[model samples]
Target: MSSPKILSVDDSRMIHTLINKGFAPYDVQMFFASNGAEGLEAAAKEKPDVILLDVTMPVMDGVECLGKLKADPALKDIPVIMLTAEAGKENVLKIAKMGVRDYIVKPFTEANVIDRVSRLVTLKPKSAAAAPAPAAAAPAAKKARIATDAIKILVVDEHPAIAESIAKAVSKRGWKVVPCAGPAEAQPHIASTVSSEETPDVILVSLAFPGKGALKFYQSVRMNPTLKGIPMVGLSVKTAIFDQNEAKETGYIAIFTKPLELGELPDRIARAMDLDITPIFYSSEGDCQVVSIPQDLSETGSIDLTRQSRKKVADFVNAGFSKLIIDLTGVTKFEIPLIRAVASIIHECNGLDIKWRIVGDDADNLPNLPTVISTNLKVAALKELPNPFTNTAPLDIYPTRAAAAAAF
Candidate 1:
């Protein structure tokens, strides 16, 4: 009958505050520690049901603390959900090897924290049974709105107001909207729906916090064979070219700015999920082959772009073309993966004794590329294309180029 105790080990006061606010609705008791050492000591005294561990800290880091916790006989069995900013595959594998129950990426919403913790401990307080009877009817009403054959859409956003508005808009079309506060909550929902008849037709994830769990979630889903093909759209408040590019690089089908045009969302979602969407167009000028990338390069589009680039480069080389030009003039924004794809094309051209140049505005510098190849204008890049081959310096100076090019 005692309340379930939960311990949070993090260096950030803001994260601690968010956790408190997130779990306030539940019946659990909360404890906090500023570092891994303090957290280990607190865990021994409190014997909490769950521990939320942060990866990066001033004192002992989360990974070291996790190893120590797992090694301890008394605390080893206690479920630990890691809170981390590092969403890379290598990091996830490392944490998983440490035997943590689960991990949630940072900049998470209240619902995200609660969703992960609830999986490990009883979150509802004993007082939950005393709630008014009328409140129980809400679930039935929600269930009625979702027809068994309806298109299922998953909307993940941290802000309650924004999430609700999206849910309301999508529900009007008779589609079922499964709204989640963050990536942690979204993952479970996505898994549960996979085998069901109403599996999501499209998924909309918020990019409010770029490197936080959103990109990580997208990466995780893509890695899973069952969930990889689903269309995913990114929701954002950012209008900067680089921000949009970052979202695209994560392989979102489309990036829509907030406050969203609810009226157009349904149509966009349909188009994204449509199998008959038009392919990216290619044109030839003189000896150069120019490919124009789509404005919204969704997951499918990204794959197509890569495939088309390879085929085009091969075809152009066979036709005796001397250069390949990726006309990104129409592309205001793009993802990191796209850049890698372009780099791959350039590498292929190099082997074929041909040259390649990317044409785009220089307001935002391309990530993971060296200055030798990048230029502010198409004319400048075209003129300088032959300079690298003329120089005898080792390509080691552009270290990130080959590594980034091979990443995808």
Candidate 2:
């Protein structure tokens, strides 16, 4: 079978990351464009099997692009999916009138992208592809795993591997994870907990639970007077809009779309359960304060990281540390949210007169972030980001933590 060609026309680099990661297991020929005008040019040339077109973009917006696509008989035949936000009802209605095959909302995961595209094209897993896939597991780092086991989490899913992955990730924060095979086994355990007056702190249930058992479980739990308000977080595929809505209406505390950001899961659980999430990203190295950035940072996660780092930076400065090392070595996705956070932290460091350097690489796009940031000088996301930190520029990014520390 020929590799399916997929074109993404979105300005956000993070969307590219999503597509790349989600489709990593498949043999796909993917193309990307920064805007709609560029998209038209690429679509004309590449002639992909499908196009994932964003609604709002620079140069030409999705609406205009769609109009042009339809106007041109050759391009009009290719299936197009609209990328939009939930709030853009008028535009969605307009695009629907234009006969789009489907639409995906903002803040979506690769699961959403794959689900939609699969409807138009047959997606084959890479395992069944013609060539053998080479895979490697990174060596696990020794982290300060779980200070205490005060919080008990119940993870109910059809797949034990998934439940185990969630367990291993969240267990780092010292939360006790109870994995249940399905609603059948989970109910008995949940019931037993109530008798002991020790019900779980939070429940993570799959929205795609076999036999729609997740909804049944949620409703049963909600209707139970004893466990009426226990926090319940729903895990769902990106395109499960109906399941998500039903989960919301049925009173789910939060809904996290899969593939789950395991790095951010602990923080989300902390917020939902009202647990004190001491920053796991901070450390002391000799006379320097080392800050490690999380790899999977969401918009809200970025805000929280900045807020947490601000307090830590002050504490470290008062402790007589003269240098700050903002580590971005593991970060590959440099979305707008993280950019805002990094800029804010750097700006804060400047105000306190602390010398700081970033630890990252060209591959992760860290070295070029400050350059792009300097362009929009008036944006409040980083008022001081454009200004010179030294005589050179707003940032001094190094290739490694040792190099950054040595330079400072």
Candidate 3:
């Protein structure tokens, strides 16, 4: 059998890149189109097994493209999943009337994307569907192989089966899983903790949890000073646009569609809690020195990341490296102190006549320093770097630090 073809229609090149990486492990052919018009053309020619259509686009939007697809005799039978930033009820009804197979909101995880795509397309072989092998090793060994510290997670789901499945997956990673049936049941767990370490590192609440009370629970948590920082992710059977919008508006770090991808739950938890599983590293690629930050810097233990960054920069400068690239793609939060520290470092780099650029999505969130250049794409950052001796302005400049400071 030939590889399944997956077509993605989006105006953002970053989304296209993410889709490619999310499905890289699977056995499938991926196609890309900038807008609905291009998507329609690609659909007719490729006849892709699955289409991931973005709702908002120039020239033609996803709804229009989906309408065209459903109307076409050859493409009408193909499955299409809607992707959008808006999850309003109105949008959901509009897409539902058009017959989309499923919908995924923005800021989704790689696992979320893969899980949804798998539901719509048969990318793997039947022989690869063997039952998972049982673990013969001790739980201690599993814990040692995974996390060094015990992670505590509070799971609130009305559905017993789904909650148990989620608990089982989290337990495999050596984390402690506390299962609660509803907001009332979960209250004790949240209130019992006296300190951050004692508290659940993260909470997974089902939107449909008994009484539709997950939002109430989220509000309560946010109102409490101690629990406010503890990230919460929503799980829901409702893939409708309105439900998604509600989940996001309720301030969930992410809202995943059920059934959850058991294997990917722990990683999602780590991301939601901003836990850094690995240490940041520095490497050299040709003429550029690349410093890759950890996926979650907020969990970097007792070490002062900002100070460490300063020392690293001093060392790099002393070692005669003129061009540096700091990769912050894995970092989720950009605190003001971090911004100030980075700005100071960039100022130092400027004094040393060193050229530098930062690659990450939160660059926009960073306080713009005149000395620093940032780009959402790594290649774009690298391409735009100017020679230090030329005294020319850096390319692809972001908003200035003054503007960011004022906004803050």
Best by the TM-score measure: 2
Which tens-of-lDDT digit does each residue in 280-394 have in candidate 1? Answer: 3566765466655544444434444454566566656445465656545444454443444454566556655565555554335432234433432134323322322333232
Better candidate by lDDT, 1 or 2: 2
Candidate 1 off by > 4 Å: 125-408
Model 1, TM vs. native: 0.33
Per-residue accuracy of model 3 over 222-310 as CA lDDT, tens digit each? 77687877789888875555666777897988877787766556666765666543333456755666655544333222133434455
lDDT (10s digit) by residue, model 2, range 10-95: 87555655676678788789999878899999999999999999988898888889888888888998899989886477867878
Off by over 4 Å in 2: 1-152, 159-177, 192-201, 207-230, 237-243, 258-278, 294-300, 317-322, 330-338, 360-369, 376-408
Clashing pairs in 2: 146-174
Query: Which candidate comes out best when scored by lDDT?
Result: 2
Cα shift from native, residue 350, model 2 (Å): 2.3
TM-score of 2: 0.46
Q: How far is 101's C-alpha from truth in model 3 (Å)?
A: 0.9
State the weakest 10-residue window (summed lDDT) of model 3: 399-408
lDDT of each: 0.67, 0.76, 0.68
